[model samples]
Target: MARLADYFIVVGYDHEKPGSGEGLGKIIQRFPQKDWDDTPFPQGIELFCQPGGWQLSRERKQPTFFVVVLTDIDSDRHYCSCLTFYEAEINLQGTKKEEIEGEAKVSGLIQPAEVFAPKSLVLVSRLYYPEIFRACLGLIYTVYVDSLNVSLESLIANLCACLVPAAGGSQKLFSLGAGDRQLIQTPLHDSLPITGTSVALLFQQLGMSFLPFSMSSCRSL
Candidate 1:
């Protein structure tokens, strides 16, 4: 049960330079920034769970979930990314509070940064490695940016519009199957600007799923 088009596309870089919150605190100290009481698995990016719920298991059908991209050199030249979610709520109480009688409990909440974006700053100096999104999953991660200027078809059309496809125009892409196997590759030549209107106000502060990728392909993966 691996939806969200499956998931996979985590590039990295940022050996130090880039300031203003120090490139999102070094991309959250190399992907390990899970807040909200930690439980939502998926360290760096790409998270869309629902199958068996609870970080689903059974030899992992689809697991990886974490996406943090940072490059905020101070202000407008923004470049930040963070996505994490694991939410469930249903808590009610009233066992004689005022003479009535109540009991309804079901609580669970782990919404890390949720989601945040602000690409541009020329796509993080034409992003080349940024850190390969921390690798793992079929492994092939790559990264190597050293003064890159920009223009590899506008950095592959802004990373093919941040690839999140799967319905029809297939393009795999998912993560969280366990780390270090090696296959995720990285290497670009260029690329944004209000950091793209604060990346739509950081995807509305993280309740993402703008769904696109040609309507998320159509489903099934």
Candidate 2:
């Protein structure tokens, strides 16, 4: 449920503060990232069951949900995500636990790569781990695994820093072949006789390059 956003790009800075006023601080002076204790559950969000109707049945772990909030150092800006976990199980006769305990087995599914993320969570949560997303994310944090001690801001900042490229890096590869074309050139290999009117006369015959007959002399032409 994380957008993996980095707030540093939007944070306060030094030069902006000095120019504003006599006693004011930099406009972009500090970052927005924080740890969980310092950042509280963003207060007063109403939660309800999924609309229209709801049904509950799980072969394994209980359904879990959380609301996360990310904020800046000054608490000026905020972002949030809703995260939920689910189990994935299928009723298959051959795939039962006893049949595959010591045997080599393989399973396959036909779907797009986009579906793998969601399906993977279901697959793991249904059979092996009940809390697949939280469990996997827990391995990432060396301290306080699954305690949710990390603030939404810090989580977003770190995730974005890992996945997103910096602003100017994207254009580097595309510009490598630039300047290969000759925009303004004179032919050093050719011999040419030039007169001011002679150059104009040549393309005029071709008709594509020259727009003749001025409006000032329209009737005469």
Candidate 3:
């Protein structure tokens, strides 16, 4: 398993198949996010796969990306201000972080209350560059698969992520198991490679470990 970091990212091509770009318009999808204590919320946030946030800066020229990092306010995972989503204050540019966070209550993007905000933000780009998009989605897939989920939907997403390739047609994918297990892809199996693993193995390996699933905090990937 990868070490927990301040931020984690995974990239992949939403294109249903490898190489060829199809289902491009399905980029915008809603993630069935959850809250602390694991409760489903109806007004789930919307993810803009190709939002302007993809644009990269001079130091990193890739895409214009926005800033959003949602944490479980009730859990210790709340690393920083949960109001960071206020960075979307499109009307104000070059503003102070404190100002934006302070004014978030009335921003209308979310509720004036902190707990009403969505779980996280989704970054997306176009399929014009099929390879690039696939690489991006593949990166996100790695983190999405490895981490434990906070809800059933997240678990389902993790399961589906296994079949998701590095690109639409790319053979690369991630494998998950106990810390003791090794990662090796077997083309004969044509699936995520693991050392004869199973659900029991994962619990056995992860159970004794000091790292709790909540320690992973908010994952941007």
Q: Write the per-residue lDDT of candidate 1 for residues 1-221, one digit (tens) a residue.
A: 11111122233233245444423211322222232231222333312111122231113122233333333333322222222222222223213232223675444433332222221111122222233333321122111123334333333333323433212222334333222232222211112110212244344467565634222221211
Please give the lDDT score at residue 44 for candidate 2: 23
- Clashing residue pair totals per candidate (backbone < 3 A): 33, 9, 26
Cα miss at 165, model 2 (Å)? 12
Q: For each candidate in the order shown, give its overall lDDT on alpha carbons.
A: 0.27, 0.27, 0.28
Q: For model 3, what is the error of residue 44's alpha carbon versus the real structure, in angstroms, after optimal superposition?
A: 7.2
Cα-lDDT of candidate 3? 0.28
Worst 10 residues of 1 by lDDT: 187-196
Question: Which tens-of-lDDT digit does each residue in 1-221 have in candidate 2?
Answer: 11222222111112222343322112121134342343333322212112111222233334343323434457543433223223243323222232234576544533222110010111011011113224323332322224645453454334333221222112111110212121111111122211112344444566634344332222211
Candidate 3 Cα errors over 4 Å, as ranges:
1-28, 31-62, 76-134, 138-221
Name the weakest run of 10 consecutive residues (lDDT summed) in model 2.
115-124
TM-scores, each model vs. reference: 0.19, 0.18, 0.20
In the order shown, the candidates' Cα RMSDs to the true structure are: 20.5, 23.6, 20.2
Better of 2 and 3 by lDDT: 3
